[model samples]
Target: MGQRTLVVVPRPDGGFDCRYAHWGVTTDPFSGSRPLGRDWSGTAVCAELDAGYDRLLVAAARPRWYCVCWLDPTLTDPDDVVLARTDDPDRLRERWTEAKSRAVDAVARGTAPDAARAALLLGLARRADACHRADDASFLRDDG
Candidate 1:
Protein backbone atom coordinates (compact mmCIF):
# COMPACT_ATOMS: atom_id res chain seq x y z
CA MET A 1 0.00 0.00 0.00
CA GLY A 2 1.03 3.66 -0.43
CA GLN A 3 2.45 5.38 2.60
CA ARG A 4 -0.80 6.30 4.28
CA THR A 5 -0.68 9.64 6.09
CA LEU A 6 -3.30 11.27 8.26
CA VAL A 7 -3.27 14.91 7.12
CA VAL A 8 -4.23 17.09 10.09
CA VAL A 9 -4.94 20.81 10.07
CA PRO A 10 -5.71 22.59 13.33
CA ARG A 11 -8.91 24.56 13.17
CA PRO A 12 -8.82 28.13 14.51
CA ASP A 13 -11.57 27.35 17.04
CA GLY A 14 -9.30 24.82 18.78
CA GLY A 15 -9.74 21.60 16.89
CA PHE A 16 -8.38 19.82 13.82
CA ASP A 17 -9.55 19.12 10.30
CA CYS A 18 -8.10 15.86 9.07
CA ARG A 19 -8.04 13.57 6.07
CA TYR A 20 -6.35 10.38 5.00
CA ALA A 21 -3.72 11.00 2.34
CA HIS A 22 -3.05 7.74 0.57
CA TRP A 23 0.15 9.05 -0.99
CA GLY A 24 2.39 12.19 -0.81
CA VAL A 25 4.49 11.01 2.12
CA THR A 26 7.94 11.19 0.49
CA THR A 27 6.88 12.50 -2.90
CA ASP A 28 6.64 16.14 -3.96
CA PRO A 29 3.02 17.24 -3.95
CA PHE A 30 3.89 19.96 -6.46
CA SER A 31 5.79 17.84 -8.92
CA GLY A 32 6.25 14.27 -10.12
CA SER A 33 3.62 11.78 -8.91
CA ARG A 34 0.75 12.48 -6.56
CA PRO A 35 -1.98 10.72 -4.68
CA LEU A 36 -4.51 9.20 -7.04
CA GLY A 37 -7.64 11.35 -7.35
CA ARG A 38 -6.47 13.91 -4.77
CA ASP A 39 -7.67 17.43 -5.63
CA TRP A 40 -4.41 18.87 -4.32
CA SER A 41 -1.82 17.47 -6.65
CA GLY A 42 0.58 17.92 -9.62
CA THR A 43 -0.17 20.41 -12.41
CA ALA A 44 -3.37 21.59 -10.83
CA VAL A 45 -1.31 22.89 -7.93
CA CYS A 46 1.65 24.14 -10.02
CA ALA A 47 -0.68 26.18 -12.19
CA GLU A 48 -1.44 28.37 -9.23
CA LEU A 49 1.32 28.02 -6.67
CA ASP A 50 0.56 31.05 -4.52
CA ALA A 51 -3.18 30.55 -4.63
CA GLY A 52 -2.63 26.86 -3.98
CA TYR A 53 -0.34 27.67 -1.12
CA ASP A 54 -2.91 30.06 0.24
CA ARG A 55 -5.64 27.50 -0.02
CA LEU A 56 -3.59 24.92 1.83
CA LEU A 57 -2.69 27.32 4.62
CA VAL A 58 -6.15 28.75 4.99
CA ALA A 59 -7.38 25.34 6.02
CA ALA A 60 -6.71 26.50 9.58
CA ALA A 61 -7.96 30.05 9.03
CA ARG A 62 -10.74 30.02 6.48
CA PRO A 63 -11.00 26.61 4.81
CA ARG A 64 -8.98 24.89 2.16
CA TRP A 65 -5.52 23.46 1.19
CA TYR A 66 0.31 22.20 -1.32
CA CYS A 67 3.74 22.54 -1.99
CA VAL A 68 4.54 19.19 -0.55
CA CYS A 69 7.99 20.51 0.17
CA TRP A 70 7.01 23.71 1.98
CA LEU A 71 3.86 21.88 2.82
CA ASP A 72 6.35 19.64 4.56
CA PRO A 73 3.37 17.46 5.21
CA THR A 74 5.54 14.79 6.70
CA LEU A 75 7.27 16.65 9.51
CA THR A 76 4.68 19.19 10.72
CA ASP A 77 2.47 19.42 13.84
CA PRO A 78 0.44 22.24 15.46
CA ASP A 79 2.44 22.64 18.69
CA ASP A 80 5.90 22.98 17.15
CA VAL A 81 7.80 26.23 17.60
CA VAL A 82 9.45 27.43 14.43
CA LEU A 83 13.18 27.32 14.97
CA ALA A 84 13.99 28.89 11.61
CA ARG A 85 11.98 29.47 8.51
CA THR A 86 12.87 29.47 4.83
CA ASP A 87 10.79 30.33 1.79
CA ASP A 88 12.79 28.01 -0.44
CA PRO A 89 10.77 24.96 -1.36
CA ASP A 90 13.80 22.82 -2.15
CA ARG A 91 15.32 23.36 1.27
CA LEU A 92 12.07 22.51 2.97
CA ARG A 93 11.83 19.33 0.95
CA GLU A 94 15.28 18.28 2.06
CA ARG A 95 14.36 18.92 5.68
CA TRP A 96 11.20 16.85 5.59
CA THR A 97 12.89 14.07 3.63
CA GLU A 98 15.55 13.75 6.29
CA ALA A 99 12.91 13.58 9.00
CA LYS A 100 10.99 10.89 7.18
CA SER A 101 14.13 8.80 6.72
CA ARG A 102 14.86 8.94 10.42
CA ALA A 103 11.42 7.62 11.26
CA VAL A 104 11.71 4.83 8.72
CA ASP A 105 15.07 3.94 10.23
CA ALA A 106 13.52 3.78 13.66
CA VAL A 107 10.93 1.38 12.34
CA ALA A 108 13.68 -0.74 10.86
CA ARG A 109 15.79 -0.95 14.01
CA GLY A 110 13.01 -1.01 16.57
CA THR A 111 11.69 -4.16 18.13
CA ALA A 112 8.09 -5.22 17.56
CA PRO A 113 6.34 -3.01 20.13
CA ASP A 114 8.45 0.07 19.57
CA ALA A 115 8.42 -0.50 15.85
CA ALA A 116 4.66 -0.32 15.59
CA ARG A 117 4.36 2.79 17.72
CA ALA A 118 7.21 4.58 16.00
CA ALA A 119 5.68 3.72 12.69
CA LEU A 120 2.43 5.35 13.72
CA LEU A 121 4.04 8.52 15.02
CA LEU A 122 6.38 8.82 12.05
CA GLY A 123 4.68 11.66 10.25
CA LEU A 124 2.45 12.82 13.10
CA ALA A 125 4.59 15.42 14.89
CA ARG A 126 5.49 17.93 12.18
CA ARG A 127 2.00 18.49 10.86
CA ALA A 128 1.47 21.37 13.26
CA ASP A 129 4.51 23.16 11.92
CA ALA A 130 2.68 23.58 8.65
CA CYS A 131 -0.53 24.67 10.36
CA HIS A 132 1.18 27.28 12.51
CA ARG A 133 3.19 28.70 9.63
CA ALA A 134 0.07 28.78 7.53
CA ASP A 135 -1.78 30.57 10.27
CA ASP A 136 0.96 33.15 10.57
CA ALA A 137 1.10 33.71 6.85
CA SER A 138 -2.65 34.14 6.75
CA PHE A 139 -2.50 36.63 9.56
CA LEU A 140 0.14 38.61 7.74
CA ARG A 141 -1.99 38.70 4.63
CA ASP A 142 -5.03 39.89 6.54
CA ASP A 143 -2.97 42.62 8.19
CA GLY A 144 -1.53 43.89 4.95
Candidate 2:
Protein backbone atom coordinates (compact mmCIF):
# COMPACT_ATOMS: atom_id res chain seq x y z
CA MET A 1 0.00 0.00 0.00
CA GLY A 2 1.11 3.58 -0.53
CA GLN A 3 2.01 5.88 2.35
CA ARG A 4 -0.47 8.28 3.92
CA THR A 5 -1.46 10.82 1.31
CA LEU A 6 -4.18 12.92 3.02
CA VAL A 7 -6.59 13.03 6.00
CA VAL A 8 -10.36 13.36 5.89
CA VAL A 9 -13.68 12.67 7.62
CA PRO A 10 -17.25 11.94 6.62
CA ARG A 11 -19.08 14.59 4.70
CA PRO A 12 -22.61 15.65 5.61
CA ASP A 13 -24.08 14.65 2.25
CA GLY A 14 -21.54 11.87 1.66
CA GLY A 15 -20.50 10.66 -1.83
CA PHE A 16 -16.71 10.29 -1.69
CA ASP A 17 -16.53 13.70 -0.10
CA CYS A 18 -13.64 15.59 -1.63
CA ARG A 19 -13.82 18.16 1.19
CA TYR A 20 -12.02 16.33 3.99
CA ALA A 21 -10.40 13.97 1.50
CA HIS A 22 -7.52 16.43 1.45
CA TRP A 23 -7.06 15.66 5.11
CA GLY A 24 -6.67 11.93 4.23
CA VAL A 25 -9.75 9.98 5.28
CA THR A 26 -11.96 8.52 2.52
CA THR A 27 -14.99 6.52 3.56
CA ASP A 28 -18.22 5.19 2.00
CA PRO A 29 -19.51 8.76 1.83
CA PHE A 30 -21.96 10.34 4.27
CA SER A 31 -24.89 8.29 2.94
CA GLY A 32 -22.77 5.17 3.61
CA SER A 33 -23.97 3.53 0.42
CA ARG A 34 -21.45 1.73 -1.79
CA PRO A 35 -21.25 3.49 -5.12
CA LEU A 36 -21.37 1.10 -8.06
CA GLY A 37 -17.94 0.14 -9.40
CA ARG A 38 -16.08 2.23 -6.87
CA ASP A 39 -12.34 1.51 -6.79
CA TRP A 40 -10.90 2.23 -3.34
CA SER A 41 -7.74 0.19 -3.68
CA GLY A 42 -4.80 1.86 -5.42
CA THR A 43 -6.53 5.22 -5.06
CA ALA A 44 -6.83 5.13 -1.28
CA VAL A 45 -5.62 8.36 0.32
CA CYS A 46 -4.37 7.57 3.80
CA ALA A 47 -3.73 10.61 6.00
CA GLU A 48 -3.17 14.25 5.26
CA LEU A 49 0.45 14.73 4.32
CA ASP A 50 2.29 16.24 7.34
CA ALA A 51 0.99 19.53 5.90
CA GLY A 52 -1.37 18.64 3.07
CA TYR A 53 1.28 18.57 0.36
CA ASP A 54 -0.61 16.00 -1.66
CA ARG A 55 -3.73 18.14 -1.61
CA LEU A 56 -1.79 21.04 -3.01
CA LEU A 57 -0.35 18.77 -5.66
CA VAL A 58 -3.79 17.54 -6.60
CA ALA A 59 -5.10 21.08 -6.86
CA ALA A 60 -2.14 22.24 -8.90
CA ALA A 61 -2.70 19.36 -11.25
CA ARG A 62 -6.01 21.04 -11.96
CA PRO A 63 -6.15 21.49 -15.74
CA ARG A 64 -8.17 24.70 -15.49
CA TRP A 65 -6.77 25.84 -12.15
CA TYR A 66 -3.78 27.85 -11.10
CA CYS A 67 -0.73 26.01 -9.77
CA VAL A 68 -0.30 27.38 -6.24
CA CYS A 69 2.27 25.60 -4.14
CA TRP A 70 2.39 28.17 -1.36
CA LEU A 71 -1.20 27.36 -0.41
CA ASP A 72 -0.27 23.69 -0.05
CA PRO A 73 2.53 22.56 2.21
CA THR A 74 5.54 20.46 1.17
CA LEU A 75 7.90 18.12 3.03
CA THR A 76 11.36 16.60 2.77
CA ASP A 77 10.17 13.15 1.65
CA PRO A 78 9.61 14.08 -2.02
CA ASP A 79 11.29 17.42 -1.45
CA ASP A 80 9.85 20.58 -3.06
CA VAL A 81 6.92 22.72 -4.04
CA VAL A 82 5.10 22.06 -7.30
CA LEU A 83 4.22 25.61 -8.33
CA ALA A 84 7.26 27.70 -7.52
CA ARG A 85 6.41 31.34 -7.97
CA THR A 86 8.70 34.17 -9.02
CA ASP A 87 8.91 37.82 -7.90
CA ASP A 88 9.02 39.06 -11.46
CA PRO A 89 5.44 39.69 -12.56
CA ASP A 90 6.39 39.44 -16.23
CA ARG A 91 8.14 36.10 -15.72
CA LEU A 92 5.27 34.73 -13.67
CA ARG A 93 2.76 35.78 -16.28
CA GLU A 94 4.78 34.10 -18.98
CA ARG A 95 4.98 30.90 -16.96
CA TRP A 96 1.23 30.90 -16.39
CA THR A 97 0.61 31.40 -20.08
CA GLU A 98 2.95 28.57 -20.92
CA ALA A 99 1.31 26.26 -18.40
CA LYS A 100 -2.17 26.99 -19.70
CA SER A 101 -0.94 26.40 -23.23
CA ARG A 102 0.61 23.07 -22.29
CA ALA A 103 -2.48 22.01 -20.39
CA VAL A 104 -4.59 22.85 -23.42
CA ASP A 105 -2.30 20.75 -25.58
CA ALA A 106 -2.55 17.83 -23.16
CA VAL A 107 -6.34 18.01 -23.09
CA ALA A 108 -6.50 18.34 -26.85
CA ARG A 109 -4.47 15.15 -27.13
CA GLY A 110 -6.74 13.47 -24.57
CA THR A 111 -4.05 12.50 -22.08
CA ALA A 112 -4.88 9.59 -19.82
CA PRO A 113 -5.83 10.23 -16.18
CA ASP A 114 -2.93 8.10 -14.90
CA ALA A 115 -0.50 9.97 -17.08
CA ALA A 116 -1.96 13.28 -15.96
CA ARG A 117 -1.66 12.25 -12.34
CA ALA A 118 1.95 11.24 -12.82
CA ALA A 119 2.72 14.47 -14.62
CA LEU A 120 1.30 16.56 -11.78
CA LEU A 121 3.10 14.56 -9.08
CA LEU A 122 6.39 14.62 -10.96
CA GLY A 123 6.04 18.28 -11.79
CA LEU A 124 5.59 19.19 -8.11
CA ALA A 125 8.44 16.93 -6.98
CA ARG A 126 10.83 18.55 -9.42
CA ARG A 127 9.73 22.03 -8.42
CA ALA A 128 9.82 21.37 -4.68
CA ASP A 129 12.90 23.47 -4.02
CA ALA A 130 11.70 26.34 -6.13
CA CYS A 131 8.35 26.32 -4.33
CA HIS A 132 10.12 26.78 -1.02
CA ARG A 133 12.30 29.61 -2.25
CA ALA A 134 9.14 31.42 -3.26
CA ASP A 135 7.80 30.85 0.25
CA ASP A 136 4.23 30.40 -0.94
CA ALA A 137 2.09 28.26 1.33
CA SER A 138 -1.53 27.75 0.37
CA PHE A 139 -4.27 25.11 0.27
CA LEU A 140 -7.36 24.66 -1.86
CA ARG A 141 -10.76 23.28 -0.86
CA ASP A 142 -13.12 21.73 -3.38
CA ASP A 143 -16.53 22.44 -1.86
CA GLY A 144 -18.20 20.81 -4.80
Candidate 3:
Protein backbone atom coordinates (compact mmCIF):
# COMPACT_ATOMS: atom_id res chain seq x y z
CA MET A 1 0.00 0.00 0.00
CA GLY A 2 1.08 3.56 -0.62
CA GLN A 3 1.88 6.05 2.07
CA ARG A 4 -0.91 7.60 4.10
CA THR A 5 -1.12 11.11 5.50
CA LEU A 6 -3.23 12.32 8.38
CA VAL A 7 -3.94 16.01 8.92
CA VAL A 8 -5.14 17.39 12.23
CA VAL A 9 -6.54 20.82 12.86
CA PRO A 10 -7.66 22.57 16.01
CA ARG A 11 -11.27 22.69 17.09
CA PRO A 12 -12.98 25.43 19.08
CA ASP A 13 -12.95 23.46 22.30
CA GLY A 14 -9.13 23.60 22.44
CA GLY A 15 -8.87 19.98 21.38
CA PHE A 16 -8.04 18.80 17.85
CA ASP A 17 -9.78 17.03 14.97
CA CYS A 18 -8.13 14.79 12.39
CA ARG A 19 -8.73 13.39 8.93
CA TYR A 20 -6.69 11.05 6.82
CA ALA A 21 -6.14 10.31 3.18
CA HIS A 22 -5.17 6.88 1.96
CA TRP A 23 -5.67 4.70 -1.04
CA GLY A 24 -8.88 5.83 -2.76
CA VAL A 25 -10.47 7.06 0.45
CA THR A 26 -10.17 10.35 2.25
CA THR A 27 -11.59 11.50 5.53
CA ASP A 28 -12.30 14.90 4.01
CA PRO A 29 -16.04 14.47 4.04
CA PHE A 30 -16.60 17.76 2.30
CA SER A 31 -14.68 16.68 -0.79
CA GLY A 32 -17.56 14.61 -2.06
CA SER A 33 -21.27 13.96 -1.77
CA ARG A 34 -20.85 11.52 1.06
CA PRO A 35 -22.12 12.23 4.51
CA LEU A 36 -19.84 14.00 6.91
CA GLY A 37 -17.93 11.84 9.33
CA ARG A 38 -17.70 12.78 12.96
CA ASP A 39 -14.58 14.65 13.89
CA TRP A 40 -11.98 12.55 15.68
CA SER A 41 -10.42 14.03 18.76
CA GLY A 42 -6.66 14.25 18.45
CA THR A 43 -5.63 12.60 21.67
CA ALA A 44 -8.18 9.83 21.74
CA VAL A 45 -8.01 9.10 18.04
CA CYS A 46 -4.23 9.17 17.69
CA ALA A 47 -3.95 6.86 20.64
CA GLU A 48 -6.40 4.52 19.02
CA LEU A 49 -4.46 4.61 15.75
CA ASP A 50 -1.22 3.83 17.61
CA ALA A 51 0.29 7.06 16.30
CA GLY A 52 2.16 9.03 18.88
CA TYR A 53 0.23 11.92 20.39
CA ASP A 54 3.46 13.79 21.03
CA ARG A 55 3.36 14.98 17.47
CA LEU A 56 0.01 16.57 18.13
CA LEU A 57 1.51 18.28 21.13
CA VAL A 58 4.27 19.64 18.95
CA ALA A 59 1.75 21.02 16.52
CA ALA A 60 -0.14 22.60 19.38
CA ALA A 61 2.95 24.48 20.51
CA ARG A 62 2.57 26.84 17.59
CA PRO A 63 0.18 29.78 17.79
CA ARG A 64 -3.25 28.27 18.29
CA TRP A 65 -4.97 30.37 15.66
CA TYR A 66 -4.60 28.05 12.69
CA CYS A 67 -2.05 25.28 12.96
CA VAL A 68 -2.05 21.78 11.51
CA CYS A 69 -0.29 18.49 12.12
CA TRP A 70 0.86 16.34 9.24
CA LEU A 71 1.41 12.67 10.04
CA ASP A 72 3.13 10.73 7.32
CA PRO A 73 3.26 6.95 7.48
CA THR A 74 6.42 6.78 5.38
CA LEU A 75 8.53 8.46 8.04
CA THR A 76 10.34 6.45 10.66
CA ASP A 77 9.52 6.42 14.32
CA PRO A 78 9.82 9.75 16.18
CA ASP A 79 10.38 11.77 12.99
CA ASP A 80 7.17 11.47 11.06
CA VAL A 81 5.81 14.75 12.31
CA VAL A 82 5.37 18.11 10.61
CA LEU A 83 3.67 21.00 12.36
CA ALA A 84 2.49 23.79 10.13
CA ARG A 85 0.73 26.98 11.02
CA THR A 86 -1.23 27.68 7.88
CA ASP A 87 -2.27 31.26 8.51
CA ASP A 88 0.62 32.34 6.29
CA PRO A 89 1.31 30.42 3.14
CA ASP A 90 4.79 31.89 2.96
CA ARG A 91 5.76 30.06 6.13
CA LEU A 92 4.85 26.76 4.51
CA ARG A 93 6.94 27.58 1.46
CA GLU A 94 9.88 28.54 3.64
CA ARG A 95 9.59 25.30 5.60
CA TRP A 96 9.56 23.26 2.42
CA THR A 97 12.62 25.07 1.09
CA GLU A 98 14.49 24.61 4.34
CA ALA A 99 13.67 20.93 4.58
CA LYS A 100 14.74 20.30 0.99
CA SER A 101 18.01 22.09 1.68
CA ARG A 102 18.66 20.04 4.79
CA ALA A 103 17.99 16.80 2.98
CA VAL A 104 20.37 17.82 0.20
CA ASP A 105 23.03 18.91 2.64
CA ALA A 106 22.89 15.62 4.51
CA VAL A 107 23.47 13.75 1.28
CA ALA A 108 26.31 16.05 0.19
CA ARG A 109 28.12 15.78 3.50
CA GLY A 110 28.66 12.03 2.94
CA THR A 111 26.42 11.22 5.83
CA ALA A 112 23.92 8.45 5.42
CA PRO A 113 20.84 10.21 4.20
CA ASP A 114 17.95 9.77 6.59
CA ALA A 115 15.23 8.19 4.51
CA ALA A 116 12.50 8.99 7.00
CA ARG A 117 13.58 12.59 7.32
CA ALA A 118 13.80 12.96 3.57
CA ALA A 119 10.38 11.42 3.12
CA LEU A 120 8.82 13.69 5.70
CA LEU A 121 10.45 16.70 4.10
CA LEU A 122 9.15 15.73 0.69
CA GLY A 123 5.69 15.23 2.14
CA LEU A 124 5.75 18.69 3.64
CA ALA A 125 6.99 20.14 0.37
CA ARG A 126 4.17 18.50 -1.52
CA ARG A 127 1.61 19.79 0.97
CA ALA A 128 3.03 23.29 0.71
CA ASP A 129 2.96 23.12 -3.05
CA ALA A 130 -0.61 21.89 -3.03
CA CYS A 131 -1.73 24.71 -0.75
CA HIS A 132 -0.26 27.30 -3.08
CA ARG A 133 -1.75 25.65 -6.11
CA ALA A 134 -5.15 25.61 -4.48
CA ASP A 135 -4.87 29.29 -3.69
CA ASP A 136 -3.93 30.07 -7.28
CA ALA A 137 -6.74 27.99 -8.60
CA SER A 138 -9.24 29.69 -6.36
CA PHE A 139 -8.00 33.09 -7.42
CA LEU A 140 -8.25 32.18 -11.09
CA ARG A 141 -11.69 30.74 -10.65
CA ASP A 142 -12.89 33.86 -8.90
CA ASP A 143 -11.45 36.07 -11.59
CA GLY A 144 -13.13 34.08 -14.31
Candidate 4:
Protein backbone atom coordinates (compact mmCIF):
# COMPACT_ATOMS: atom_id res chain seq x y z
CA MET A 1 0.00 0.00 0.00
CA GLY A 2 1.18 3.48 -0.82
CA GLN A 3 1.76 5.98 1.95
CA ARG A 4 -0.42 9.03 2.49
CA THR A 5 -0.07 12.12 4.61
CA LEU A 6 -2.79 12.90 7.08
CA VAL A 7 -3.57 16.51 7.91
CA VAL A 8 -3.98 16.99 11.63
CA VAL A 9 -5.53 20.01 13.35
CA PRO A 10 -5.77 21.09 16.92
CA ARG A 11 -9.08 20.79 18.67
CA PRO A 12 -10.56 23.55 20.80
CA ASP A 13 -10.91 21.27 23.81
CA GLY A 14 -7.33 19.93 23.45
CA GLY A 15 -5.59 17.18 21.47
CA PHE A 16 -5.34 16.94 17.69
CA ASP A 17 -7.70 15.66 15.00
CA CYS A 18 -6.80 14.02 11.71
CA ARG A 19 -8.93 15.68 9.08
CA TYR A 20 -7.68 14.85 5.61
CA ALA A 21 -6.07 11.99 3.71
CA HIS A 22 -3.42 13.26 1.31
CA TRP A 23 -3.52 10.28 -1.06
CA GLY A 24 -4.09 6.55 -1.11
CA VAL A 25 -6.88 4.88 0.83
CA THR A 26 -9.57 7.11 2.32
CA THR A 27 -12.75 6.31 4.13
CA ASP A 28 -15.87 6.45 2.04
CA PRO A 29 -18.20 8.84 3.80
CA PHE A 30 -21.35 7.19 2.51
CA SER A 31 -20.41 3.62 3.32
CA GLY A 32 -18.10 4.14 6.23
CA SER A 33 -15.55 1.90 4.57
CA ARG A 34 -12.07 2.49 3.31
CA PRO A 35 -11.75 2.70 -0.45
CA LEU A 36 -8.71 2.03 -2.54
CA GLY A 37 -7.78 5.18 -4.32
CA ARG A 38 -4.45 6.39 -5.55
CA ASP A 39 -3.50 9.94 -6.30
CA TRP A 40 -5.84 12.33 -4.54
CA SER A 41 -7.07 14.90 -7.00
CA GLY A 42 -5.55 18.36 -6.81
CA THR A 43 -8.98 19.88 -6.21
CA ALA A 44 -9.56 17.67 -3.20
CA VAL A 45 -6.13 18.43 -1.80
CA CYS A 46 -6.73 22.17 -2.27
CA ALA A 47 -10.08 21.91 -0.51
CA GLU A 48 -8.38 20.34 2.48
CA LEU A 49 -5.68 22.98 2.32
CA ASP A 50 -8.37 25.65 2.31
CA ALA A 51 -9.97 24.11 5.36
CA GLY A 52 -6.63 24.14 7.12
CA TYR A 53 -6.18 27.78 6.17
CA ASP A 54 -9.63 28.55 7.57
CA ARG A 55 -8.67 26.91 10.82
CA LEU A 56 -5.58 29.11 10.95
CA LEU A 57 -7.71 32.22 10.47
CA VAL A 58 -9.95 31.15 13.27
CA ALA A 59 -6.90 30.46 15.40
CA ALA A 60 -5.57 33.92 14.67
CA ALA A 61 -8.67 35.49 16.21
CA ARG A 62 -9.13 32.97 19.01
CA PRO A 63 -5.40 32.27 19.74
CA ARG A 64 -6.02 28.70 20.88
CA TRP A 65 -6.86 27.12 17.54
CA TYR A 66 -4.36 25.77 15.01
CA CYS A 67 -3.92 23.32 12.13
CA VAL A 68 -1.00 21.20 10.97
CA CYS A 69 0.00 18.44 8.57
CA TRP A 70 0.95 15.16 10.19
CA LEU A 71 3.71 13.61 8.12
CA ASP A 72 4.77 10.87 10.48
CA PRO A 73 2.27 8.78 12.35
CA THR A 74 4.68 7.54 14.99
CA LEU A 75 5.34 11.06 16.24
CA THR A 76 2.86 13.71 17.38
CA ASP A 77 4.80 16.71 16.13
CA PRO A 78 3.40 18.52 13.13
CA ASP A 79 5.45 18.46 9.95
CA ASP A 80 3.96 21.66 8.56
CA VAL A 81 1.89 24.36 10.17
CA VAL A 82 -1.14 25.15 8.07
CA LEU A 83 -0.82 28.88 8.39
CA ALA A 84 -1.25 29.97 4.80
CA ARG A 85 -4.33 31.83 5.85
CA THR A 86 -5.34 34.56 3.42
CA ASP A 87 -8.33 36.53 2.28
CA ASP A 88 -7.67 35.53 -1.28
CA PRO A 89 -8.47 31.84 -1.83
CA ASP A 90 -6.54 31.82 -5.06
CA ARG A 91 -3.31 32.56 -3.29
CA LEU A 92 -3.64 29.51 -1.08
CA ARG A 93 -4.59 27.47 -4.13
CA GLU A 94 -1.43 28.56 -5.83
CA ARG A 95 0.59 27.54 -2.81
CA TRP A 96 -1.00 24.09 -2.91
CA THR A 97 -0.10 23.75 -6.58
CA GLU A 98 3.46 24.83 -6.01
CA ALA A 99 4.02 22.53 -3.06
CA LYS A 100 2.54 19.52 -4.81
CA SER A 101 4.53 20.27 -7.95
CA ARG A 102 7.73 20.37 -5.98
CA ALA A 103 6.98 17.09 -4.27
CA VAL A 104 6.08 15.38 -7.54
CA ASP A 105 9.14 16.76 -9.25
CA ALA A 106 11.37 15.51 -6.48
CA VAL A 107 9.86 12.05 -6.66
CA ALA A 108 10.18 11.97 -10.43
CA ARG A 109 13.82 12.99 -10.27
CA GLY A 110 14.55 10.24 -7.69
CA THR A 111 15.45 12.71 -4.96
CA ALA A 112 15.70 11.18 -1.52
CA PRO A 113 12.78 11.61 0.88
CA ASP A 114 14.82 13.95 3.04
CA ALA A 115 15.41 16.29 0.13
CA ALA A 116 11.97 15.86 -1.42
CA ARG A 117 10.08 16.39 1.80
CA ALA A 118 12.24 19.41 2.54
CA ALA A 119 11.10 21.15 -0.63
CA LEU A 120 7.45 20.85 0.35
CA LEU A 121 8.16 21.62 3.97
CA LEU A 122 10.12 24.72 3.04
CA GLY A 123 7.25 25.93 0.90
CA LEU A 124 4.88 25.57 3.81
CA ALA A 125 7.26 27.23 6.23
CA ARG A 126 7.79 30.17 3.90
CA ARG A 127 4.06 30.68 3.50
CA ALA A 128 3.58 30.62 7.23
CA ASP A 129 6.43 33.07 7.70
CA ALA A 130 4.98 35.41 5.11
CA CYS A 131 1.63 35.39 6.86
CA HIS A 132 3.28 36.02 10.20
CA ARG A 133 5.28 38.91 8.84
CA ALA A 134 2.19 40.43 7.32
CA ASP A 135 0.34 40.11 10.59
CA ASP A 136 3.23 41.66 12.46
CA ALA A 137 3.53 44.54 10.00
CA SER A 138 -0.19 45.24 10.21
CA PHE A 139 -0.08 45.24 13.98
CA LEU A 140 2.83 47.64 13.99
CA ARG A 141 1.15 49.97 11.54
CA ASP A 142 -2.00 50.01 13.61
CA ASP A 143 -0.14 50.59 16.84
CA GLY A 144 1.94 53.39 15.35
Candidate maximizing lDDT? 3
Give the lowest summed-lDDT range of ten residues in model 1: 49-58
Those runs of model 3 whose alpha carbons end farther than 4 Å from true positions after fitting are 1-18, 21-29, 32-39, 44-79, 94-98, 107-144
Lowest-lDDT window of 10 residues in candidate 3?
A: 132-141
TM accuracy, model 3: 0.33
Tens digits of lDDT, candidate 4, 1-144: 222333333344533333333332223321322332333332333334422233322212222222233222222233333334334434555565566666666667776656665565566666543333222223211211
Candidate 1 lDDT over residue span 1-144, tens digit each: 343333334444533334444443333333323322233322232222321121232233432223332322233432322212223334554555566566545556753534533443344334323322332333312312
Supply the global lDDT for candidate 4: 0.37
- Residues 11-115 of candidate 2: C-alpha lDDT, one tens digit per residue: 234322232222322232223222222222212322222322433222222211223332211122332334443333234434534553554467558865445
Give the CA lDDT, 0 to 100, for residue 24 in model 4: 21
Model 1, residue 38: distance off in Å is 14
- TM-score each candidate: 0.27, 0.27, 0.33, 0.35
How does each model score on lDDT?
Answer: 0.35, 0.33, 0.38, 0.37
lDDT of model 2 at position 8: 30
The TM-score, computed over Cα atoms with residue i paired to residue i, of candidate 2 is: 0.27
All candidates: CA RMSD (Å): 12.2, 14.5, 11.7, 12.6
> Candidate 1 or 3, higher lDDT?
3
